[model samples]
Target: MAAQSNAATAGTATVQGLLSELAALEDPQVRAVNERHGDDHGVNLGQLRAIAKRVKPQPALARELWATGDTAARLLSVLISRPKAFTAGELDAMVRQGPVPKVNDWLVNYVVKKSPHAQVLRPAWLADPDPVVAASGWALTSERVVKSPDGLDVDHLLAEIAEHMATAPQRLQWAMNHCLAQIGIELPEHRAQALDIGARLGVLKDHPTPPNCTSPYAPLWIKEILRRREAG
Candidate 1:
């Protein structure tokens, strides 16, 4: 019991030190993140990565930091978290607690999908009524389709996209559209079908495209990414 108490105290000190580093690095002028995610600590990805490297992976400390931290600290917590340390209930609470869309993206991609527990949680998240949960589900689906589409019901996924893409909450719509783009790009058998859905829905049509990047309009996005891959 003494050993355990000592370990807990050590973890708390480590997390506190990390939080101090983040606060020291915070830049109030980094308002672009605030515009994009409604939260910003002025810490860039590079700084986050550097801090993550310093702290290493301390999943226990991560949970403590997340519980008491602000947006940037939460981001740091996720960066240093180990997927194996969390239960499904804990993951669910973390997702809800980190409500910003950018944070959700990080949690789904960096934490949940990488966890051994992903398969057990994916379907439940998809079926959840919460928009963020459903969006995380779609993000998981997107990762699955890209990495392994073997047993996935292509028809069912397409049907879901066609039916719900228009009315899905903003974050979910982004994810669902990602599903459409992934289908069109990754699975040859589904490409034509995904393209058809894109043409019909005109997903994100007129969303501005940067000079070098492809547009997010689904059909064009899918086609361009595929073309680039082929060229490379």
Candidate 2:
């Protein structure tokens, strides 16, 4: 029993150290945890979550960041970039910044790819009143929204996009293909619309501009989606 207790204590310290490191990790937070240099930048997400589960449950840094919404909080609340547990308000701000490419990149890569809170983000975003914010709702819905066994009211969403597609071609194009790549066409009608919109919008096209040279796969899907729409 004594030996077991000693082992547990050692493990606890290791876990806490790991969490603090992740709360500070940045660059590798993208690319699904930067396989080659994960150790250097920070630990991978799966390990972070597991360790956090065992440690004293602290409110996720994102929750505090959302409540605070200050610059220092943004820098300090590094865990907001992680999928572990995101505050709803911060999620709203990220989505609101949808029109900004940098914000989009952060939302898709850091927040969506790394975190599971996307599930919580989808529905609320889908219902946003503003088209730009609603565009983000569609954008993330395709990426992180968990597929429901019963299914989503995707037709209404598509109709909503189509209604605005001509006027807001660029945004509509991005949102549709975003869904297409992630959600796929399980629903034949939605898939047909998705492929049509995605292909028309150039949903799969690559862009000459890159966000970071080290990580080049930035927003090609959106470029392609737009291209297809322009051609059609």
The numbered model that scores best in TM-score is: 1
Every model: Cα RMSD to truth: 4.8, 10.1
* lDDT for residue 103 in candidate 1, whole number 0-100: 76
Clashes of each: 0, 15
- Model 2: runs farther than 4 Å from truth? 1-80, 97-99, 112-117, 144-150, 180-186, 193-232
Q: What tens-digit string does per-residue lDDT give for candidate 1 at 1-232?
A: 3322332333344655666666666676775656566665677768777767766788777887788847777887888899888898888888877777667778888899888888778888888889888889888888899898888888998998899898888788888999889989999988899999989988798898889988889999998998899999
User: What number of backbone clashes does candidate 2 have, counting pairs of residues 3 or more apart or in separate chains?
Assistant: 15
Per-candidate Cα lDDT values, in order, are 0.80, 0.48
**Candidate 2, position 137, lDDT:** 64
lDDT of 2 at 32: 41
Q: Each candidate's TM vs. the true structure?
A: 0.89, 0.44
How many angstroms is residue 69 displaced in model 1 relative to the true structure, after the best TM-score fit? 4.5
Off by over 4 Å in 1: 1-13
